[model samples]
Target: LPAPILRLAAVLITSGLLILGCDENQQGFLLTNRPIVYLGDISYVVYLAHWPTIILWKSVSDSTSLSIFGIFNCLLITFKISIVAHHTIEQFFIRSKVKAVSIVVSLIYGLLAIGLMFNVPATVNTSVASRAASVDVAAAIEWNERVSHNAYRQHRPCKECLDDPEGQRMRGGYTGKGDRFECIWKPDKANGSVKILIIGNSVAHLAISILKPVIEENFPQVELVRLYSMPACRPTEVVQYVCPPYHKALPKQVQAMKPDITMIMYDDAILFITSSKIGQERKILKKTFNKYKV
Candidate 1:
């Protein structure tokens, strides 16, 4: 396959993994069977060894001079080495030999490793402090309170609203009337800039705060026009749920705003099924992109 096709496939696979990881049920791609459970059994060893194996190979090899063939050869060599190490060394010697004596020995070594991993600053840098300071925490709490009050103001009945009505209403328009939540935008009055439309789901909405400062600093000539939905919805969902009666529909709303660029970030994992279904979605997305010249 082409490099672009391979890149797309990698992206889709990564998205699938993210979805599986985020899923509370831990079913992964296999909803009906226990494939993830089976995989999870050996995942710890794979996780522990794969990174070091890759790093070791890359460290020895001339990565800059590696061609596609060379890369493939490296991968094959790494796979063989990993299989041998896992089956012969890790599984047989470390995991399979779990007698009472071995268990005690393992516990002593395990505690040492854990202590080294956590305590040694030069090894892991465990002393790193959170950027979210006491003031930031207070601000976040204040924001939460505002959102709660806002929810109650909008007559939202969720427990969050009861707790902090003001904050909920201000930040997220969590009115109990519907599933949709309106985004709050505060445009800079001094600098009149062209509106840039932001459309998609929660992820896209989350990007707004991060993007806001960047846009204001870098692209000061542009204003933001946001059209965001909840976690479960996407662009397609916008067409279905948002259109009728609401003056500001989804894509139409975006188009009418006449944004220079439409940035869309959605969770494709919501539509994930089996690997076959994922492949089909990729095909469909490619076709749709081509049809619209997206």
Candidate 2:
């Protein structure tokens, strides 16, 4: 549908819903019921928190899809959180004399200050040798900078790039690279940069890291663009916590960059699926690939 038609349709639908909701003549039992009224009260809070809850669930489970048990637990948790937020934060903001905007800004700055204080040591990129040299005492201090001694840490965060303990041994915890999931790598502008979009999950990151030197040496014109890489996420129709952002951003990136090539590297099949859903997932995956392909 066109923009006007879509807007008209949305208005009509909303108006219809409003009319039905306000209808005194019709049976109001469902709308007036305590449970329904309570849900209505907390619906906005649920709207705001549901997405973060799902992402947190995915992080905790390390899986894309939820089981029946997981869904029940999620709903239970969401409702509990929503009810609490509705009664406390939501009510306070709605009813308080103090400006909500000012309070929110103050809270944000306070949390930022705390985070900076805690994270400053980890983000410091200077070598132990450099720090040791700065302190002017004649005490012999031996610092073993390499924890896992894995070369992969030089490319990206070993935590983000590697999954196994064996690979992790090479990575000393997470490098600052772990904090970023996406960035564009620009080759030297003097050589003439060729934009090649590198996308998909961590495998794509690994692939580019391995192949990057070869590209720079052989294909001197190629510039790497890392758009998105979320674990257990791919360009597919299957509803995972990460897929929506990937899909939403792809077209915008494509439009903006107009890359000469778009390379997708991920697991061939959906991360989580039943035997029965494989065929359906395969079709959806194919469709998504077709849609996103440049």
Candidate 3:
């Protein structure tokens, strides 16, 4: 399935389907079906309503569960929401016959929905106001003066970010080669939180994208410990990578940080290539184990 050929085929198929559907003479069986016709009226509403429900369901439980009852429940819930949305929101707008009002409502709903999805507040409360009111003028002025000198640290687009400003360093916080401090991220908060160290390859990085959000939202107390990784760098230190200057760096970092637990992510396929140097890998890895003193 080359991309170009597949794309060309998709275009041709879509065009053919459109051409076939343009006929008033050839009424389709699906279009004539009672259930489908009912669904067609609220199809857009179903699509809109289902996404949030699915996201919620996934966050709470297994998204890929194939149990028949689970599938039925998901569909039933989505259908019920779609019915409500169609009758109340969708049909109300259509009957009102105000395209401008509909567009405005749509934009407002979309923005609010997107905000809530990202855990943004829909309304400000007393706590927010209280915090703003509590800021002292003297402290603010002092902070402003401090910012005047070390302004580069406040890089725009990522200013005062998460990850410990104090402890962050590159090469998994290992002091090696050039400064890799900016590349490494440690927790600025969660002083009493359990430390977790994660090291791995590209796949691991993708997992981190999903992980970082969950940890921030649910386990904010836990510090994300050493996160040393590059595209092809193996925890076994048998692969060559261009970044982080990580050759023989993991053991020293592990001893230094003393993470509560260490997690390693790697591509098993690379094992074949690494197998060539298994003896050296064993020796290097054994040193890490011995230092752990477990």
Q: lDDT winner among the candidates?
A: 2
Model 3 agreement with the true structure over 98-211: per-residue lDDT tens digits: 887778789999998998886667345555756688679689877665433233224311222344433333225544343122223444655544565666654344344444
Q: Candidate 1: where is the Cα deviation over 4 Å?
A: 1-177, 184-186, 189-192, 236-248, 268-294
Query: What is the clash tally of candidate 2?
Result: 0
lDDT of 2 at 121: 54
Which TM-score value belongs to model 2?
Answer: 0.34
- Cα-based RMSD of the predictions, in order? 17.5, 16.1, 14.5
What is the Cα root-mean-square deviation between model 2 and the actual structure?
Answer: 16.1
Ordered from best to worst lDDT, the candidate numbers read 2, 3, 1
lDDT of 2 by residue, 1-294 (tens): 334675899699767757777877643865767876787789899988888887898667645765456566888889899989999989987787678757887999999898788885555645544776766444332122221123323445322233333212222322123322454555453264455555666555555454454455555545443434545556543444435555565566556555555666565432322234234433433344444312
The deviation in Å at residue 92 for candidate 1 is 30
> How well is each residue in 197-253 modelled by candidate 1, as lDDT tens digits?
445444454445555544455454444444344433455332223323222345345
TM-score of each candidate structure, all chains considered together: 0.30, 0.34, 0.31
- The true-versus-predicted C-alpha distance at residue 9 of model 1, in Å, is 33
Model 3 lDDT-worst window of ten: 268-277
Q: Evaluate model 3: give its lDDT.
A: 0.53
Question: In model 3, what is the error at residue 45, expressed in angstroms?
Answer: 0.7
